[model samples]
Target: MSSAHELTQEQSDRYWQDGFLFPLSVFSEDEAAEFRAELEQVEKDWLAADLPLPLNTYKRVNAHLVIPLAARIAQDKRILDTVEGVLGPDIMIWSAEFFIKEPQTKQTVGMHQDLTYWGMGETPDQVTAWIALSPATVQSGCMDFVRGSHKNPILPHTDTYSETNLLSRGQEVAVDVSEDDKTHIELKPGQMSLHHGLTIHGSGPNASNDRRIGLAIRYLSPGAQQLVADRDYAMLARGSDAHSNFVPVQAPDALFSPEALALYEQVRLDQSKALAEGADSAVPLYTKM
Candidate 1:
């Protein structure tokens, strides 16, 4: 892997200590704009066709499976290099989702640890790379992290299944988080942040005039496995995966190709089985807007 964009020792230490690091320049402004345009164009075309599932459904889970642009971004060397600094040479992309908060929307992601419902146990090998395609500021609902919270064991969570919550289960940490404990991470377009899977974090509603668009790509090492599910899929973004804990997948050649769409459907259904486990509500995840 290229060392050009790898995280420095101090940066890695900060991440391990604080559970999150932000404002890493991963893409140029022009490049980020191009990616945003591609995403918006896909949204425009798909929405016009009036697909049975909502547009947000496609954006919320494994978007890289069907969107070539998303796949390319997920496998970008700059991203992989930085990821490798913490996860070692071998890294697998577990999932990628576009978390979009439209202007003046009530959509909020309550304070929660991601691993609470992922069924992945308390593994330290997993990290989430959140790339900002738009300005992520306080008004744009930028994520807030509780420093060193990843050190805690997986905490209790209550599923809200709220219409305005963006989480798969609308889950939140059972404990109240004080505002003073939070570190609001703001990023400009083309910048990114990395947070541990066990990190306690959340974002409020987008009150800005423009949308807050972020592409969150989950990465895991070769040793990671899905204990609760029969099978799981991932794309090897870095070195070889000797463990083969996850089924291997290739990047799509075209956006929403017939083959890609079929694969995405199968992945969506199978993955939801794990994500929705033990949920109180029967409402399927990534199925509604």
Candidate 2:
């Protein structure tokens, strides 16, 4: 894999200006196809299960085991190089999520910074690599971002659905922003978009006939700390001693090889220690609007 040290000056500058960047063909078509097959198998297994689904089933419904195909892509030299360039040498696979937009599904995500969900401190170092496992188009609810929103103050967020919608989990309503200022991100299979953790973004509902699936891999800088007292979400340290609270999911080993695993284990241990020390001093990063 190429080292993060090799990013061109232009690539680095673009990321700083745009708050997001799309790198073409990060994965080969063949590699994407294999991962899609694995995802399908997982979905089938979930459907055949007899137990009642969890309350957070929509978020936890997808299986996250690092299939061999995905593992290979996660370790791709080019990806590692770019991510390292943005986040620095020491990093951890913070989390991975499968965003599956079913056809005709009217579930739109509200415009908000990722840190709003993560509950981490405001720092420009964190990065998220969102890979398109299938063709992602505007019709299929492709992602949208406020071009320079990363430079703006973090906005309040709310649930994407209305009170009438069945999936409402009482998520905060997103702050209003102008549509004219947003940029749509459309990608073909194998392409990926990398964004800052504080970038203001969201997606529309899938109105197309096919499913729009994206695998988002989140990365944290080496020194990022975790807040343990916060029960609603996991927070990563970035600025001062404050952290942002985001939903914490189990780390998947498939995404990390032996070398990555070693780094992840060390970070996990350190995070545990920090949580233990600050067990009684957790604070909210934002207030309700």
> Which candidate number would show the highest lDDT if scored against the true structure?
1
Q: Write the per-residue lDDT of candidate 1 for residues 1-289, one digit (tens) a residue.
A: 3466899999999999999998899999889999999999999888756444566676788888877888899999999989988899999988899999999999999999998777688998799999999999999999999999999999999999888999877899999999999999999999999999889999999999999999999999988878776778999898999998888998899866778877877776667667877776675653332
Model 2: runs farther than 4 Å from truth? 1-6, 50-76, 159-174, 228-289
User: What are the per-residue Cα lDDT tens digits for candidate 2 across 158-227?
Assistant: 4433532222232333667787877889998888888987788778889999888888777676445444
Q: Which ten residues in a row have the lowest lDDT in candidate 2?
A: 280-289
Candidate closest to the true structure, highest TM-score: 1
Candidate lDDT values, in order? 0.88, 0.59
Q: Cα miss at 279, model 2 (Å)?
A: 20
Question: Model 1 scores what on Cα lDDT?
Answer: 0.88
